[model samples]
Target: MALKYVEEYRDGTLARDLVKKIHSVSKKKLRLMEVCGTHTTSIFRHGIRSVLPKGITLLSGPGCPVCVTAQKDIDAFVAFARVKNVIVTTFGDLMKVPGSSSSLTKEKACGADVRIVYSVFDAVNIARENKDKEVVFCGVGFETTIPTIAAGILMGIEGKLDNFSIYSANKLTPPALAALMETDGVQIDGFILPGHVSVITGTDAYRGTFEKYDIPSVIAGFEPIDILQAILLLIQQNEAGKPALENAYPRAVSHAGNVKAKQIMNQVFEVCNASWRGIGQIPSSGMELKKEYQRFDAAIKFAMDMPDVPEPKGCACGQILMGLKTPEECVLYKKKCTPMNPVGPCMVSSEGSCAAFYRYS
Candidate 1:
């Protein structure tokens, strides 16, 4: 029965029917952007682009957390790794991401105590075990992860783990969407919003951006059927000359989203201006620890102020993230950059659009 439920969404017949509907209705030259890295991976993995009409072009957005992490933030994480008696814990995807001068992977090779952790709780546990050493978790994510990081901080407080801190490069999704709409030369007819983020923020999180831009948006799950249905919806909305914020992944997402998770997140963090790897600073697009939780902030605790640096020359990661260029269009994509050796964060992250394009395209 479980197998049946999973297979139904991947059913070839159902997918084919949806593809046919998309091709039939997609008459205009609509350039839709998928605002989640998972959606980009699912689209490429399932060959959703190949099935869709040529008129409907799907562009990847600044959705991957690691991909969009500012260069200075990466530098800060690297700097943290170099500090004396400091153990830098981060998600595995961030290991190879090049900072201004170094990366955690390189620092680890040079005897820096850099550890890859699956969860923020794991980092907290590491701090608990090594009370003598300072454990700084590289906090990089969206609404989907902020709550867990918040919970981990609360755990630290309960245990009185003074050795633990988090360098939050956390970003919010809605403001970034608005920034994209305001940027010149960015042509997006609709948005295929992130499913995982929507599960936490609910459909209501996007209402402000939706109302401001009045762009056709749909929250979609990371499945072939889900993506195809989202594409069809976007095409339908464009063809009808009507724009609406719709939730196609209603199974996991709701109007209010996960209230408890949001409340927990709000308890620990507050909004701030956050910089993006490719995109510049967007107002109130970042989350930092609150004044009461300032003790848990690695940036404030260490007084590490990393300067804004230029990205690697000839790397179109910023342009690519903004949907101005595809991976193939980048000069360093297959030549100077590969998954084995990434010049930019976009190629290093698992859900990165460049990685997806390289793996599948």
Candidate 2:
């Protein structure tokens, strides 16, 4: 049964069949945006881009959480590292992301208390162990990771760990998708939706946006067959002149997502205006600690006031995220902005389109 399951999804025969079907149905040139960082990585890892027809252009949207996090938020994290007796904790990817002036790694090298944590609960534990020091977690993610962060706050509160707080830069996936639709000069025929985010927000969360824009969207898993199937579905919809939102990854996603997780996220955080690294501020796209949960807000606790710093000059990360430009088109790409020294967040993040392109292409 296990062998059948793996072969069913990853079988060469199935993937080739889907690709042939896609090529047969696809007559018109179409632009499809994959709105998840992991999808971008998977597509590259599986060499899906090379197999696709030249008529079908796949663009990577604002999928990387670390890539989309605004420069101001990075600065705030760096600010925490500079504070005396304060422990700044964040995911490993965030440690290399440069702020307006410096990065967490640089701060740590300068004798600051910066730590890389795998989870928010680990930061909470650090706070619990060191009562004399303040532990601030740099929270940067989308719907897929927000619920766990919310639960960690509740855990801290229950344990009476007052020293723990979070500088939330969490973004909502549906809102970003809506924002992309409204962007000028952006043309997307279909949306290859994210599987993980859909598992949290569900197919219903994308209904309003799909109804408004009337774009064909398919929530797909990470497997090669799964992506190829989604592409075939998108081609069929475009050929029939029908635009609808559908879930291709039914085994993992549903109409109604994890209800308890949503409740916990709502209990701890509220919607606010959020700044995207290259896309600017999208209203009600960011998550912040609620009024009752203000005690756990790291920005509030540290009195952090980050400056409105602009992105790196000549970096086309914003345009790349919006599908207006590809990473190869960027002047900084491969010249000055390699993975070792990324000029923009797109190169720094593992899920970033630029990073995938560099690795695969």
Candidate 3:
């Protein structure tokens, strides 16, 4: 069979050439961080780390939505499960994230009526079917998934599904990048920016961050070639002492991004301060339902209030997310916290650095 478009990008010869170029140009001890969980997994899956030069180190950032979700938010999801006549719906990754005292899976096992939903619309459909039951969807993701949730809210409004609501833990990318730069011990030479999030936010969304920090950054696709290409670009920039933000995946991304999707998002939601698991609250980094859309706000409807909780002791998820440590450096990594019994959100979520390390490394 002829090679498909995607398969062509994964070609062995092309990848090797990029790797050789990366080794050649990479002379400085560069700490390049792939600021997307998907990129983290992809790098590990393709053994990109193994092929890289000894001086070049790749770090994982606060890119995994589930991994970065605050402890209080997880507690809120569990709290939703405890509400009477409430059907708590969420993405599959959230099922195992350990909240302060309990997880959604534990709540469901204790009969809290938690359901795994693939989309926000699925939760809306459930709410429509069970008119008497309050359906709360745990909305957690980045720009790629937030607009769809907004569209689902619009759908719920059209269908008059008053029982349907969402607890939005949706986050923004650029703000988090700025937060990373400000972090005390966090050291990153460059960033392998998220491709999917960049598709919606466009390259322009990061221009402010890039211009302010002057870090060599590149938006890359999930494929090995794309990542290698991005690494090569970052290396080239660093070697030449020229920092820039470039788009390696221009086929799917542009300078302005998806305007219609952003418009839909802005219409339904507004910016708010959001807490990251390891990283503390970053201002204007979260999305919450606007006043006009508060009817769909699950936290308000259920009167849910969860106090913040500290992460597990010796669980280096926070440090790992900040690119300060790797999974191997964590005390509880494979010894105490396997995926079967995850001590941290990083182990629970598939895109998490720990989970990616466990699976691919």
Candidate 4:
């Protein structure tokens, strides 16, 4: 069959067949976690929860870029936006993530210039259009999105776009995944590894997760079939008392990953201590623009101070992000922390567990 865009991946009949197989193979109660924001959104978008058997439980994790983004960073973005001749451009989800006592949305209402972007390229274009304004892009996402961000930087450099900059908050996947697994919080029987992220980082990057913890890790696609098949593979592993790494999305992901992109990443950034809103500080999970590209580093350009921002009083976003609690567990999730007036980032970002739960649950 020929490949297309969205429809090529989302095969509904195949998904149903796989779901039936998952039900047949899964004997014991299998609690699986999908550690990708895209997967979370797909699960909700496709009504995946309703189709699943009662014996299987799917949990959310710290996968969403906006959800995992530390409040201090959002504050820093707000700070930059407030500066004269600076316009903050970011993905829509970031506008509402609470920072200090306020958010970018609140700041926008109070007249701190903030604009939404579909991609880093869009932000760059906006900078060119508004040459007098210092357009600082709020760079947030996992490996899947970082390549484009890096490409944008090179484009900026090539074009000599002096008005453009990036407040990079890009994070690594395996390190954060390991941190979640290390704690005695959630009992994740197996992991439906993020397929998009796996395409960039590869199956080799996650070999340690399987080897270290005897955890079955399967790189899964966003399609319902892919998710069900991954669960079946995991269940088979668990039943046989064997833990291993598998890739269900081989069409996109290879064992080795994208070498050229990794090279660009290595050249541009280095590992550093990263703060996840709920997951706390995971060592060497974040990327900082290297000294060679210090001129492009927004943090250095603006002299941004990352203060310890507190989570909202009644919000359980932290607990939700850890998979220790659901969005429903949070008193503020649907009430105070909603998409319209999101008290937390999770509720704002569609990929975020809270947003998924709020939208479909």
Candidate 5:
């Protein structure tokens, strides 16, 4: 029964029907951006583009946390790794992301205690085990992961774990969508919003952006059918001249979202201006620990202030994220950048647009 249920969304007959519907209704040259890294990987992995009408173009947005993380934050992580008696914990995707001078992987190879943790809890555990050393978790994620990080901080408080801290590079989704609308030369007809993010933030979270831009927007899952259905909805809205914010993945997302998760996240972190890797700073797009929770802020605890540094000269990750350019348009994409050795974070991260293009395009 479980297998059947999972396969239902992947059924070839259903997918073909949706693809035909998309082709039938898609008249205008629509540019829809999927604002999730998982969606980008899923689109390529399922060959969704191959089946879509040439009139509809899918653009990858700055959805990957690692890909969107600012260069200064990456440098800060590298700085943390270099500190004495410090255990720098992070997700595996960030290991290869090139900082200004060094990366966590390089620091680890040179005897720095940089550990890859599956979750913030694992970093907490490391702090629990090594009470004498400072364990700093590299907090990089969206709404889906922030609550867990907040819970991890609570756990640390209960256990009296003073050595645990997190350098938050966490980003919010809605502000980014607004910023995209304001960006010059970014022509997006509709948005295939992130399902995972919507699950936490709910449909209401996008209400402001939707009302302001009046763009056709649909929250979609990563499955082939889910993506195809979202594309069809956007195309239908575009063709009918009625732009609406619809939730295509109603099974997992709600209008109010997970209230408890948002409450917990708010309890620990507050909204602040945040910088993106390619794009500059977007107001109120970042989450920082609250005043009461300042003790757990790694940046404050360690005085690790990294200066703003320009990205690699030829890297166009910022442009790619903004839909202004594609990975192929970047001069360093395949020539000097690959998964093994990346010139930009877009190539290093698994959900990065360049990595997706390299693997499946």
Candidate 6:
């Protein structure tokens, strides 16, 4: 048999059948927001848009982690990299994302001691060994990755590593979705929700995106058939006039999510107001390391003074994140910005809007 959601979900015949069904049932023009970065990548990678009905419009939201990271956050990360005897640690995606003046990659090339790690735990290990230098993890992620950071914090606490700290840019998904729904630039009939984030945060987290806005949400998987099936589910909901959450990826997600991981996150992080790259400060959407984890807070340890972040000149990343424009609409998209040298994080992250647009179509 096929490997559950993996092989079974990618079935070409199933995808074709579902797409045909979507076309047959969907008579009116509908705007659906795929509120996950992976969905954006998959839509492009699979050429799903090519065969889609002209009435159905898929809008990419503020889902990509690196793209949503504000300019001030980048400045804060690079500021840490510039300090003497400080070992800056981050995931690979953060290295190329541009700050106001520079990026972590440029600092690394200049021998600024930037190290890439698989997880936050790897950063803690560096702090244990490199006693002479302070190790700061340039942590960036959404709900799916926050639990990993929480796990690392637990490890750090158990080991009592004094030298280790994390500069977390962690965020929740729903509030940003709510923010988008409130804005005039976006209007959607349904949402193809993210699968991975649902594993930790669960189906309950998406209820607000539906109940308040009256939009149907289908928590979708990465594969071709899975996405198509979710669209069908949305069409069914739209016809019935019911805006509800249906977990299409039932294998990994549940109504209640991972309780143990949520506990770990609750212990270390508290919700706080935070800014996004294109979007301004969204109230109580971001997580800050709590009072109990003060010793591990790199923002306090470094005393970084990053100014209020500014948008890049003529960059449509903000508009793109708000669903007002696509990457193709940006003047600087391919002219001044590219994968290698991105003026904005949308070009920097592989999951980023511009990168996905350029790569797939």
Measured against the true structure, the TM-scores of the candidates, in listed sequence, are 0.98, 0.97, 0.97, 0.94, 0.98, 0.96
Tell me the TM-score of model 1. Answer: 0.98
* Model 6 misplaced stretches (Cα beyond 4 Å): 1-4
Q: Candidate 6 — worst ten consecutive residues by lDDT sum?
A: 1-10
Candidate 3 off by > 4 Å: 1-4
lDDT of 2 at 250: 96
Residue-wise C-alpha lDDT for candidate 5, range 1-361, written one tens digit per residue: 3555457788899999999888888789989999999999999999999999988889999999999999999999999998999999999999999998899999999999999999999999999999999999999999999999999999999999999999999999999999999998989999999999999999999999999999999999889999999999999999999999999999999999999999999999999999999999999999999999999999999988889998899899999998999999999988999989899988988899999999998
Q: Which predicted model would earn the best TM-score?
A: 5
Q: Which stretches of candidate 5 lie over 4 Å from their true place?
A: 1-5
Best by lDDT: 5
What would the per-residue lDDT of candidate 2 be over residues 1-361, giving only the tens digit for each residue?
A: 3555445788888888888888889999999999999999989998998888999999999989999999999999988898999999899999888888898988999999988889888998999999999999999999989999999999998989999999999999988989999999999999999999889898999999999999999999988888999999998999999998999999899999888889999999999999999999998999999999999998888788888898899999999999999999999999999999888999988999998999899
lDDT of 6 by residue, 244-310 (tens): 7899999889998998888889889989987888888888789989998988989888777588866
Error of 5 at 237 (Å): 0.4
Per-residue error (Å), model 3, residue 78:
0.8
Q: What is the C-alpha lDDT of each candidate?
A: 0.93, 0.92, 0.93, 0.84, 0.95, 0.87
Sum up the clashes in candidate 5: 1
lDDT of 3 by residue, 187-248 (tens): 89999999999999999999999999999999999999999999999999999999998999
Give the CA lDDT, 0 to 100, for residue 106 in model 3. 93
Candidate 2 — number of clashing residue pairs?
0
Model 2 lDDT on a 0 to 1 scale: 0.92
User: Which scores higher on TM-score, 2 or 4?
Assistant: 2
Residue-level lDDT for 56 in candidate 6: 82
